[model samples]
Target: MSRSPCLLLLCLSLALPCMADEAKPGHMVYLRAVDPGIVQDIRYASAHNFTGHPLDGYQAPECLLSVDAAKALARVQTALNAEGYGLKVFDCYRPVRAVADMGRFANEPGDPLKTEFYPRVDKQDFWRLGYVARVSNHSRGNTVDLTLTGPDALPADTWTPSAHPVDCTAPYGQRWHDGALDMGTGFDCFDERAHTDSALINATAKANRQRLNGAMEKEGFSGYSAEWWHFTYSANTQKPDVMDFPITPLAP
Candidate 1:
């Protein structure tokens, strides 16, 4: 696919300010179109977000892609659709600013209690645990936070599969914590219990998580050991500085 030279220049200019022509550690950049298999679909999970609500300067849903990574994602979507499952993307190709926002939140004096999510540890522990790393793969446009939904929803449509708003504060099952029947925890749950193969939860939830893992692995994506919903496209898996660029889809 031919890339928009204007968009590319715009991306470079916006992401790499005049002060620094080169892409910095915390800057956003475009993904080269190496892979078309990676699919793009927004709206799989609840409108709920990690920052506890929508924040200023947020944009609508779109999939960003690294050339090869896009192909892998597209293939993954195709396979899932064949099985009557669809992808609901939370965030992809994040800009470095967004990552900074996360870090800033963690440093804040008042982060919400983690007992409901990271019950074993306090909210401050995230800083100590290194889960929220300074650099994330997402900025490279190769990593994504996602969830599975039924295929009835078209590739461009959004749907809430779990039926309720994503309650990050409630217990696992009631708040979307389990992995088996699909009502487990939200995708970005920052807890040890959200491990890809954790047994602290019920069997049903474990099975559900396993299903997600299986699907991701089949399409060249690997589940984060500490996160069930986090996946990295093997095609272009370089951990880059975090970015917060708005997702811009390739024009059809």
Candidate 2:
């Protein structure tokens, strides 16, 4: 029952394609590694986030983004750098586990950071108001939450819970400032003032939002109307697929 040499070679060839498919690298890339100029804050990796805990699956404080989206963001960083500004990302390529954690936390009552992050919004209303979702674009590895920062971007506060809680609807600097330019509200502020085009914000904050929006748009990123700091690289030809890979450190 010995097979002919030609038949064996054909069988090997048939298996090669399948093996190659299995060997394809994950499309995600570390943003800071791709562009050293871009800053990463990776909020979910730390306890400063609205969840008041380190979210699951954020194994490292890194910004993971699809290769194409990272390249596009690098271009945006370059454009911003020329204008005496740079991009500071708060979150990118969120793991599905982390998104699930957010959903679970939203369902539980008694939010510790509720005053700072969602004072006016009830926990149950997050899904109804489109603030929290079971699935997020970040899971697709192309969406990013970010803000503009200058060379003198303020340092992050010590982050101890304040004795007097501040409402998320308070002025940007009066509430929680993340060193980036005042974007009308802090990152993840679940309030109408955080809307991309909310007129309640001061003129300076409005101009800053427009500046970031214009820069991202120039590089083919579309801003989310409900969140001033959120944008997605829609120019990518690949269809977005949600992934659950943990944010691990990139190899040196």
TM-score of each model, in listed order: 0.65, 0.86
- Residue-wise lDDT of candidate 1 within 153-242, one digit each (tens)? 223223242344444435544564322225255556776567777776667557667766787888888878877778888854454433
What are the lDDT figures for the candidates, one per model? Answer: 0.54, 0.80
lDDT of 2 at 64: 84
Using lDDT as the measure, the top candidate is: 2
Candidate 2 lDDT (Cα, whole model)? Answer: 0.80
* Candidate 1 C-alpha error for residue 221, in Å: 1.0
Off by over 4 Å in 1: 1-47, 53-57, 112-120, 151-173, 176-183, 237-252
RMSD of each: 8.1, 9.6
Poorest 10 consecutive residues by lDDT, candidate 2: 15-24
Specify the poorest-scoring 10-residue window by lDDT in model 1.
Answer: 17-26
**Candidate 2 segments exceeding 4 Å error:** 1-25, 151-153, 161-165
Which residue pairs collide in model 2, if any?
Answer: none
